[model samples]
Target: MITELALRRPDDWHLHLRDGAMLQGVLPETARHFARAIIMPNLVPPVVTGADAAAYRGRILAALPAGMTFEPLMTLYLTEGTDPADLRAAAASGLVKAVKLYPAGATTNSHSGVRDFDKVRGVLDTMAEIGLPLCVHGEVTDPAVDIFDREAVFIDRVLDPIRRATPGLRVVMEHITTSQGADYVRSADRDLAATITTHHLIINRNHLLVGGIRPHYYCLPVAKREEHRLALRAAATSGDPRFFLGTDSAPHVDPLKECACGCAGCFTATNTMSLLAHVFEQENALDQLESFTSLNGPAYYRLPMNEARIRLVKGDAPVSFPDKIQTGAGPVTVFDPGFPVFWQVAQD
Candidate 1:
């Protein structure tokens, strides 16, 4: 089936484009499909302040291939000592759209994340007052919590009370992977939403360890079981505006990923639309694809949808994992399903 529809151009509410060469190489792929992306602040040393976010935004803009009209929305990384006034200033300045809260050791470059929820209350209150969203990693750092239960545990112990305490605070549960997480977002009355990653909808934990520990599939808030995958698929294609697309296309070099200390991330920016189309097709929800992929995100962020359109043709088209995408450290071969994606991006 070949269909060309003028669906709203989407924005990635959460994305990671590493700094320097990797940023230059991988950014164009995202810009080509997404109108805007809330650039993650987990770079080395991390984007801890408004100045850092602004500078990082400048780098992303400079790295874009000259004529592409994509905007990189900036975020501040919430650390143990992140100042309340600075956060308010950043939100007021409109340079920082959201503040990312990463529980210490929860994910990549997140060692500097907030160690305790209470420690950052001042900053959180400030964000709530100023109307900036809190983009969360949404996983607990407790080693005893069982790897698969981190998201659920975090929700029970931290997120729920935080939501109650800070009424009207906007929150995004980034790359959610559990039924509990999904239900929580779905039930929220305030400004709460979730970003579903393409990988989580298509793969599970077994997919990561099936053929041996697959580093490429090893992302933080790691892919869950088959049941959760089904839940994610349902949420993404259910035409629910609370659920939208955010590739979370984090990239890590080969050595970094395939080592004893394998880095946690997935580089799916290149194949995001293809994978999303594949999921929607499986669900027989092609009609709703535009809303999940393109419309919901911009609406939640209060940004205008892109007027430009992208045409995707449905048919067998090979989407292979590159042996490596050259990064500063080395090459990185992302984990791919190793098959032809029936939908291919033809125009944008």
Candidate 2:
């Protein structure tokens, strides 16, 4: 059996590092393993302008601890009133890697998201012309649609239409949670891809609901049935270039996550590499691990691969990670994979 493996450093295609205390506390968790990450723009006011992205990037760099290196690939939040000229300039200067599309009320802090697609057609055109990809949170907020079926519905009703309308617009469907999502990506020919979350690859809805309400398991585009999980596993382990790692490692404090109106997010940044190793091993496709976590993301975004490499070692005993990490705000729980994880990243 393979005991140790090394590969090029990985990049997170999707990530959430909230500003202020939370940002300072959680930024290292991801930077520790990932060389860079496509930072989510869904903040309190949102990163909507070139200046906003530049300032946010500076703040991220400022928060990063010394003796550690990590690059923040910034993004702009799409809104009806977004300025095409500003977005074009941001992309030209490489200050923004992509534009995020969150359908209004789709997930946490998404009230400022776009409600009318027509309004952003001009911005989309500018992006296509300049070769900037759009990172999308793919779930329709229609109350009538079943929560579980929202992803599939969004593909047919929203995603498909937008793609067809803007032929050259590149889109990365973020944290796809269903077979429908995987199939949709497979069916597409060009300028399309999807990001699979580390947590989704391990836990299904049962893990979230079987015993009691596991608030930590709750996340946007909530975990689906076991079959969907299996499908995602197959796609991820298949070495499909179109599918890559985007650990939407959203973190909310214990108080915010355990209360009556608990938030929807899974804090997986801390143990993502370990969990990915566990899942890939279970699929008997450990060889594909590098492609999923490291290689594929940069290729899709047209960026160069990282020169640094990380090594993972599998041992007889299970790895132990902190149950919760204490930040200035409060304690934030780590994602529990339920089963033992024997594989962990070897310390440098």
Residue 63 shift from truth in candidate 1, angstroms: 0.9
- lDDT per residue for candidate 2 within 1-348, as digits (tens), equals 888889899999999999999999999999899999999999999999999999999999999999889999999999999999999889889889999999999999999998999999999999989999999999999999999999999999999999999989999999999999999999999999999999999999999898799999999999999999999999999999999999999999999999898999999999999999988888899899999999999999999999999999999999999999888778999999898889889997
Give candidate 2 regions above 4 Å deviation. Answer: none
Candidate 1: where are CA atoms >4 Å away? 1-5, 316-323, 327-329
- TM per candidate comes to 0.95, 0.99
lDDT for every model?
0.84, 0.95
Top candidate, metric lDDT? 2
